[model samples]
Target: MSWRGKRKVEKPKSEEETSSNKNPKLESSDDSDNLFVCEISKNRRVAVRSWQGNPVVDIREFYVKDGKQLPGKKGISLSMEQWNILRKHMDEIDEAVAENS
Candidate 1:
């Protein structure tokens, strides 16, 4: 056997990386726990995420500055409990709208 110094060494691939390589758009399990943005309007959106192991919902405003839609200063982050309360009220609004329709 000749000297094997010509062999290239490579670090082991992570489980996530190997699976993702088989499918470029493969979303890992961790991605499910990530923030999901829900568009509310043309210049506004909501993001529900987990921060520091706590559930949170972020409501933010967007502005078109220099033709670039960017986040504005108007924003609020609420805990899961607060979000549940707001969601309850939103359900009432949904009921009213459905009744009108």
Candidate 2:
């Protein structure tokens, strides 16, 4: 007898079943002072949140570990001053991108 013939066929799961297994992390907690959050990709996000007593813009990459999403080391937190400077230079940045492309 061929061992391949003894394999069991598994039934396909429904959309609900498949969807229930996917747990996306929340942008902020109940007590968190997050102003905004935007997902740029499946694992990358940009968020404005309060740190200590000051607000900072955080651009971070998240990873799934033990069924939970955790921030990875590949990220940067910009202070308000830095964020403002970046915001002011957006037009120049756009021009550079347009030129490069």
Candidate 3:
């Protein structure tokens, strides 16, 4: 007598079920939608404020690993669209600085 005959077989999960368990949400947008790029440490925090004394946002987080960019734990986050907007205005800021200098 074969011992296999006494063993019970398990059914495999469907592809849809397997996928759902892996990634529950295929569409999600949060921090990736904001404009808060770049992280600054306590020591380097002054660097951010020194930019032409212009007003801007500064986000601090503890989850961010050293040497890592923003969007870190408590760090700023920016979406692709937000980045594009800033990039477009960079030329203007550069021009203003050049004129003043």
Candidate 4:
């Protein structure tokens, strides 16, 4: 008296599909192509990202979570003009740091 043969079994995935599914980070993705982010120092990063079809740069500190570096809530986003102003200030800041050294 057996009655357990009415469910449809799922087809097994191919090796490539299985491997890709197992490691999603290795898949070819272009979602981040519009955003450029990099670490400037420990716990610090600079990101050039596009928002509303406009390019913006952001500088901020980051934190580690789940063994990955994620952007922190504290950050500054700058427009092109603001970025230029920041660059000028950065040059002065660099000289000041060098003078102190």
lDDT for 87 in candidate 2 is 94
Where is the poorest 10-residue window by lDDT in model 2? 2-11
Q: For model 2, what is the C-alpha lDDT against the true structure?
A: 0.61
Q: Write the per-residue lDDT of candidate 4 for residues 27-79, one digit (tens) a residue.
A: 11323323334445566656565555566786767676666555577788888
Q: Which candidate comes out best when scored by TM-score?
A: 2
Residue ranges of candidate 3 with Cα displaced over 4 Å:
1-42, 45-75
| Candidate 1: residue 101 Cα off by (Å) | 8.4
> Each candidate: how many clashes?
0, 0, 1, 0
Model 4 residue 88 CA deviation (Å) reads 3.4
Off by over 4 Å in 4: 1-33
Among all windows of ten consecutive residues in candidate 3, which has the lowest summed lDDT?
A: 43-52
Which digits, one per residue and each the tens of the lDDT, describe model 1 over residues 1-101?
Answer: 31122212122234454334332221223434434345566666565555567777868776765555555678887998998898889978899999999
Candidate 1 similarity to native, TM-score: 0.46
Question: Candidate 2, which segments miss by more than 4 Å at Cα?
Answer: 1-31
In order of appearance, the predictions have TM-scores of 0.46, 0.67, 0.27, 0.54
Ranked candidates (lDDT, high to low): 2, 1, 4, 3
Model 3: per-residue Cα lDDT over 1-101, one tens digit each: 32112222111234444334332221113221122222233322111111133333434343223443222234343444555687799999899999999
Candidate 2 TM-score to native:
0.67
Q: Give the candidates in order of TM-score, highest first.
A: 2, 4, 1, 3
